[model samples]
Target: MTAAERRASGSLAIIFAARMLGLFLVLPVFALEAARYPGGNDAALVGMAMGIYGLTQGILQIPYGLASDRYGRKRVIALGLLVFAAGSFVAAAAPSVWWLVAGRSLQGAGAVSAAVTALLADQTRDVVRTKAMALVGASIGLMFAVSLVAAPMLVEVIGLHGLFTITGLLALGCIAVVFWWTPPAPVQHANVPRGRLADVLAHGPLLRLDVGVFVLHAVQLAMWMAVPALLVQAGLDKDRHWQVYLPTVVASFVAMGAVFALERRGYLRAVFLAAIGIVLLAQLGFLLAARAPSLPVLTALLFFFFCGFNVLEATQPSLVSRLAPPAARGAALGVYNTLQSLGFFAGGAVGGWLAKNVGSAGLFGAAALMMLVWLLAAWHMRAPQTPKTAEEVLADEAEAG
Candidate 1:
């Protein structure tokens, strides 16, 4: 990558990390914190508040991406961040669980993930795009780990409302980074053909990657619906939950590096499938651990889960960028992100219900079933070919015409 690509990728990765940190910060504490609000006692409503961001995010991702394609990535991203900050402030001031849900929905309405990712694709060359995406993925995983540790401590210091306020401020700060630091996107001809949503939708390999992302996130959100409470039951205090998270996150990063090495060695498909298998095994382990409920057992299981999660998170987007038509990259990513958000919403709502009605074991069982299906889909997915250069993309289009 050139200096400009590095700057763009670094700035964008920070922007992505900051927004994600805000979201993940709430996950560790929201279920317990919401109990103080009106309607919080209803498990379903609390879950809805937790997951409503996904609902709005799912609904608006494609539109945001399309707007980016037509207008410009930076402009769309700035607008999205402002909306996110507004939503964060609303969430910070919410007097009831339902209000928090509304705020969360607003937060999701700011969906700029597709736009940011598209810009990254635009800035980096095909040869280095995977590494750039990996950096972004690593930032997200690191943020999640940091949030897990920090949320408990922060909530103790500032409370949930204060946390939301900080999240709003963070989003506002990212807006500055975008305009001042990130490089401008290279201009393409106005008359150049762009990818149609229908074309991306009809593509088989892209759909398979979409399903992979959906199931990956769905299982993650679903598992969290129970994991926090389970940690409490296993003798860890809610405030001290980071003790488990900290070590597991460190170990997962180490494991993820090894997995990346396999991909570098041209074993992308094998590593991808194996990562799914690890997730399945982790879910199954969670189910068995629920019966016996030990902190050590639960920690080991979560470590395995994060390993799989980090690997999949890093690999999937790169595959999407490589496989999709260059002209429609933003739209394809929009569809991909929409599915990912839907998975988050579904996992939270359904997982909460399962936890409330059937118990934690049942939630894990459901997640395990989803992973089994994803594994099958991934098993049949062909490896994505390397991405073409800009000249190649234009030449291919010319040849087709």
Candidate 2:
């Protein structure tokens, strides 16, 4: 890679890292904190607060990306960050679950993920685009790890309200980075046909990928809804949750190496199915833990869960990139991302509702069901041919998955 590409990737990675940190900081602690506020006792309302961001994000991603293509990437990104910061402030000050829901909804309204992907596409060449997207993915993975470590400490010091305040300020700071640090704008081509919205919606492979992403994120959020509480019930303190998390994270990272190895050795399909099977087992473990409530068992179970999750996380986008055709890659990715956002929201809401009404066991049962459904859906999916170009591969894989 050239110096310029390296610089661009580094800056964007940091920017994404900060943004995700702000976005995810609340997830680990929100349920317990929100319970202190009015209407927090209602599981459905709390779910709404947690998941509203996904709803708006999914709804607006296409429009935001299209607008960026027409107007310009930087300006749209700046505007989105500003909106996100504003929503953060609102969430920080929210007095009721309804207000929190409103804030989360506002936060999702930013919907700049698609625009950011498009910007990277415009900024980088096709050969290196997959690497750039992987940088973005790595940023997210790092932020998730950091947030899990930092959240309990932050909540201990600043509380959830203060955390929201800090997030808002941090988001505002990202605006400056956008203006000063990112690369110069891409020169627009008049003759290159842009991906069509209708075409993106109509593609069968993209739709399958979209459903897969939705299930992936939905299961993720739903599991967390019960997992933390389960940990506490098992006698682990909030601060000490890292004892379980850190090792699992490391092990998962190590496990993901095998996934890459499989891909390099042309066993992508087998690896993918194995990862999903592990996830299925994790869900089953959760169901058992909910029934029995044992710390050692839960801890052991989570190790396997993270292993599966990390593998899937590392490989899914690569597959998506492999699947997508060149002409429609961006649009396909946009749709895939939107579904992911929707899953985040739906998972939280559904999990919270089930936890409240049917007990924690039911929450895991539902998550397990979702995984089973995804596994079934994937059973018929052929391993898509690797496209010659990364962009074509991404588009095709995304469609195929």
Candidate 3:
């Protein structure tokens, strides 16, 4: 990547990380913290409040993405951030659980993922886009780890309201980063034929990716709910689980260099399928670890999970950009993220049910099964075409005409 690409990728990764941190920060503590509010007694209702954010975010993603194409990426993103900040502040000041739900719902309404990712795609050359996206992926994983450690400590100091306030501030901070640091908007390819929702919806490969993301996030959200308890059973205290998570997440990055190497060698399909296999292996490991409850075993399993998780995260989005019509890239990603958000929402409900009726092993078993399914689907996916230059793009269009 050139210096400009590095700067763009770095700044956008931070922006992505900050938004996700705000979301993840609440997950570890929301149920506990919500109990302090009025009407927090009903567990189902409290769960509803948290789920609403994902629901609303899922609902709005495509519209926001389409709007970005019509208007502009930066404008749409800025507006979304403002709305997100407002939602955070509302959540902070809520007097009751229902209010908290309303606030969370508001937070989800500002969905800007499509626009943000589209801009990142626009600024970076395709040859380096996956590496750029890897940075974003790593940041997200890092934030999840940081949240696990920080949320517990931060909640103790400032309590739930303070956490909401911080989330709002983080959203506001992203707004500043957007205008001041992110690369200037790329010139839209207006001469390119406009694309439709059908273009994305009818595409088989994108559909596969959409399913893959859905499974990835659903498993991630559901598995984490059980993983912490497994760590506890392994003789690690709840407070000290970070000792396992932080190191595993950090160590996983060491494997990513190999992913980049293989991708550059034009083995992208091979790498993609292998990453899915690694995650499946991790899930199977979790199944065994759940039975025996060994800290060492669980830690090693986590390393493998993050390794596969980060690779899939980077490659999937890069492929979406490469494969989608130029005019419809944002819409395609919106669909991608919508499934992701839905997976998160569904994972909680499904995971809780599996854990309750079956056990930790059952939950991990289900997740492993899903990964196997995804791997099978991804096996048929075509390797991405090489990056096209402007002349190649125009020439191809002219040839088709």
TM-score, prediction 1? 0.95
Which has the better lDDT: candidate 1, or candidate 2? 1
Compose the digit string of candidate 1's lDDT tens values, residues 233-286.
899999899899988988888777675456656788988899899999999999
Q: For each candidate, give its TM-score against the true structure.
A: 0.95, 0.89, 0.90
State the displacement of the C-alpha of residue 341, model 1, in Å, after optimal TM-score superposition. Answer: 0.6
Model 1 residue runs over 4 Å out of place are 387-401
In candidate 3, where is summed lDDT lowest over 10 consecutive residues?
187-196
Q: What are the per-residue Cα lDDT tens digits for candidate 2 across 230-277?
A: 999989988888677767766666656555445545677787788788
Top TM-score: which candidate number?
1
Worst lDDT 10-window in candidate 2: 257-266
Off by over 4 Å in 3: 31-48, 95-97, 189-195, 388-401
10 residues in a row with least lDDT, candidate 1: 257-266
> How are the candidates ranked when ordered by TM-score, highest leading?
1, 3, 2
Query: How does model 2 score by TM-score?
Result: 0.89
Give the Cα-based TM-score of candidate 3 against the true structure: 0.90
lDDT of 1: 0.88
1 against 2, candidate with superior TM-score: 1
